[model samples]
Target: MIQLNTKRQFVYFIAVVLVIILGLASRKYSNFLPTFLAENAGDTLWAMMVYFGFRLLFVGKRILTAVSLSFLFSFGIEFSQLYQADWINQLRATILGALILGKGFLLVDLIRYTVGIVLAAFLDKLSLKYNN
Candidate 1:
């Protein structure tokens, strides 16, 4: 595999923080958004945040590594919703838990995740290109 350049951890950290803010704003201000955006923006931003989080954590890794890990994690959380065991459900009931684990599974969320990860990777590449 081709070696990709390392990313600036601080930049990725800022990206993650900004994405989290946007995700919260998307939910808080959903009424002002168009129907589709209101419904999908939060999830999209959530996935983007996940991608940035991975990038931040794996600073020396290729962008594909971050993208793949983000997808695996995001999809894993979504799929975990299908298992309704009491222990996990209880955990999901809490605010932080719900934010991370989610309450239920929706197929559409997978597509939203894909879009988010792809967009984040694209943006990261552009930033890298300009930085170099």
Candidate 2:
């Protein structure tokens, strides 16, 4: 189980990196993508990456653990945008902070996050079944 988990963690890490690349590309190359996808893919991939990150950290835990934690963490970050103090705003101004914390809130983002997390969890379950 430990060896299996180590392998799983490696896979999840790769997944996270891929998601990050895709997310950045979705922004950088938006002109090449479809309108809807260009508008939504970055946030969706971000949420998916978050789910994969949780899975990577909690390799032995159930899928629901990662799903639930991803939802909480993603939603928390979205809602945190409602608070705009100088310190946090300064952090949000930086490239890394803007990527992680976002600059504004959008109800659509909640929906995007929901879709991303569900899709990630579904894929994770499929991978588990295939491996088993």
Question: Best TM-score goes to which candidate?
Answer: 2
> Which candidate has the highest lDDT of all?
2
Q: Write candidate 1's Cα lDDT for 2-116 as tens digits.
A: 2434448878888998999999999889999999999999889999999999988898899999999999999999999999999999999998899889999999999999999
Error of 1 at 128 (Å): 0.4
Identify the runs in model 1 with alpha carbons over 4 angstroms from their true place. 1-7
Q: Across residues 35-55, which tens digit of lDDT does each residue of candidate 2 receive?
A: 999999999999999999999
Pick out the ten consecutive residues of candidate 1 with the lowest summed lDDT. Answer: 1-10
> Candidate 1 local accuracy as lDDT?
0.92
Model 2: lDDT of residue 127: 97
Candidate 1's TM-score reads 0.93
- Cα-based lDDT at residue 102, candidate 2: 100
